[model samples]
Target: MNKKSMSKGIIKDILIVAIGVLAIWIGLQVAFGTQNPFYVVASGSMIPVLQVYDVLIVQGHEPFEDIKVGDVIVFNRPSGQDRVIVHRVASIINDDPKIIRTQGDANPASIPGTDFPITKEEYIGKVAYVIPQIGYVTQILKPPMNYIIIVIVVGIMIVKQISKKKNDKGLNINDLFTKNNSEQTENHFSELDTLEKDKEYSTHVESKPLDEDNSKNNSDKEQK
Candidate 1:
């Protein structure tokens, strides 16, 4: 193909690959429910260990009382608020032989003071994992910074996938532009052979020396 056509083909291939990869990534994120799995460290309730904007992974709890003292649990207060509170369990109260209470790590007041000692009935899931500086993304999506970050991350992943494909294909761009070395060398030798045959034919004509045969030339001129 011509140079211009070949260049267009390469550009089209790149665009197709990029779009396909992006689509597959988005599909996976949606299918696996990864979009809903996020955490926001609202207050300094669990400070000294868990800082603000630190992402925590939460799952549905099996039972409130089943969780241990050291485990960080998410729960709500008696006000029926849907807020997630992360705190280490200080103690478990069996009031009327049917309850458990939890407290915080850095509380100035005792477990029963600020909020009533939390029963197992109010408990949510335990903290699974924490990623620092990720809650800020959850906080501000309209600021354009979140969009910029998402774009950058997606771009990096696309680039890595492209590199992987190139490696797998083993496409040597230089060799593609310049034909195979052995084939080129063979064609050069073929052209040289044709040139040598033309030279040999000219030499044979010169050796005959038609004008040197005088009688033959006189007879040839008379016939002409």
Candidate 2:
């Protein structure tokens, strides 16, 4: 109802949403085996079909032999390289042990000079989805900007906690008033007892005079 209580509630709500999102992100990583959802095209191997910086969703596939011609696929650029290349399957030149020949859409011929053989294990996955200009944004969000955003969020949470502490101190004023009021009540009761004792002593002092006056009157009547 009060400002302090409202502020605390808002902070709790913000924390809940932030934590929920983080948990979802972690769960997706475990489910998919990747933290990032999209991959950026680094080369022109799939030009005309897919350009540089074009973001595409990569999903697990069965085998390269199962892929059909005209289907866009991504695989390692070259053996022993960590980079990936995206291209279309020109044709299934050989399928005995599952080998395929791939070529870029812009290129004049297929790869490997004479049908570059790609095995079943070489193919990464087919393109699930694509966004034209969003790949550049993903690249930017990858490095320093991600860390910067995390740091800023942590700082805001720390400041909120400090503010909550200050608000708690201000709200404790009511507790102090309650303690003082209880002490005052005890003091007033003690003073009331003292006043009762004083009244009793005054009554005792007047009682002796009345008794003496009564005795004098009785003696005078007896003398007459």
Candidate 3:
């Protein structure tokens, strides 16, 4: 393909891949009933059960009223700076208006505001699944590293396409040369055949006249 068409094809493929990824993200959100269905654990507070950089799949479909003790949950920090926390439910502080207490497994005790008085407003979702250490990929893909990786991948793709085009052009030139050589060889053999046929015809014509002269001399000698 020409340069313009090849570039267009590559762009089209990239767009299709981007759209497919977006569709999958939307589908996951709709299916799990939460905008933030996935979260990566940033701390080792829940160690033994969960580690740093563990990937968590949270499910929002679990009713708030159904949250029980011993269940792990994701929630916004109750007090201080706004941050997401993943902890195990320690106790049900209240039933109505749903208040709960949470504590990290590694911590000796739960901090007052950080762990207790968790209202429904702070609730995000229940920890539905855990994938170990997969969040490290996201960590590495942050900021400058991600940009570098993208540039490297795009550069490699472009180089490969250019090399392939050059190879195709080379093959076409070699095929043209092969075709010309074949035609020249066939014409040379044809000319040689025509020359041989003409030579044979000339020899036959000269022998006929010589034979007629010899026959006339033999008839004169027989008459004498």
**Decreasing lDDT order of the candidates:** 3, 2, 1
Top candidate when judged by lDDT against the true structure: 3
Give the Å shift of residue 170 in candidate 3: 55
Clashing pairs in 1: none
Instruction: List clash counts for every candidate, in order.
Output: 0, 0, 0
Per TM-score, the best of the predicted structures is 3
Residue pairs with colliding backbones in model 3 are: none
lDDT of candidate 2 over 1-224, digit per residue (tens): 99999999999998886776566455434433444434677655444436576666554433455687756676764455455666677778776876778766544345452225666656676664454444465456876545334334433433453477543322222232256567864564345423322222233333333367755865675689
For 166-193, candidate 3 gives per-residue lDDT tens digits of: 4333222123234657785456434542
Candidate 2 stretches with Cα past 4 Å from truth are: 1-37, 113-115, 138-224
The TM-score values for the models, in the order shown, are: 0.44, 0.48, 0.62
Candidate 3 clash figure, as a count:
0
Candidate 1 per-residue lDDT, tens place, 45-109, comes to: 45544667776555443356476545566666644554556766655566454354554444432
lDDT of 2: 0.53
Candidate lDDT values, in order: 0.51, 0.53, 0.66
Clash pairs, model 2 backbone:
none
Error of 3 at 194 (Å): 99
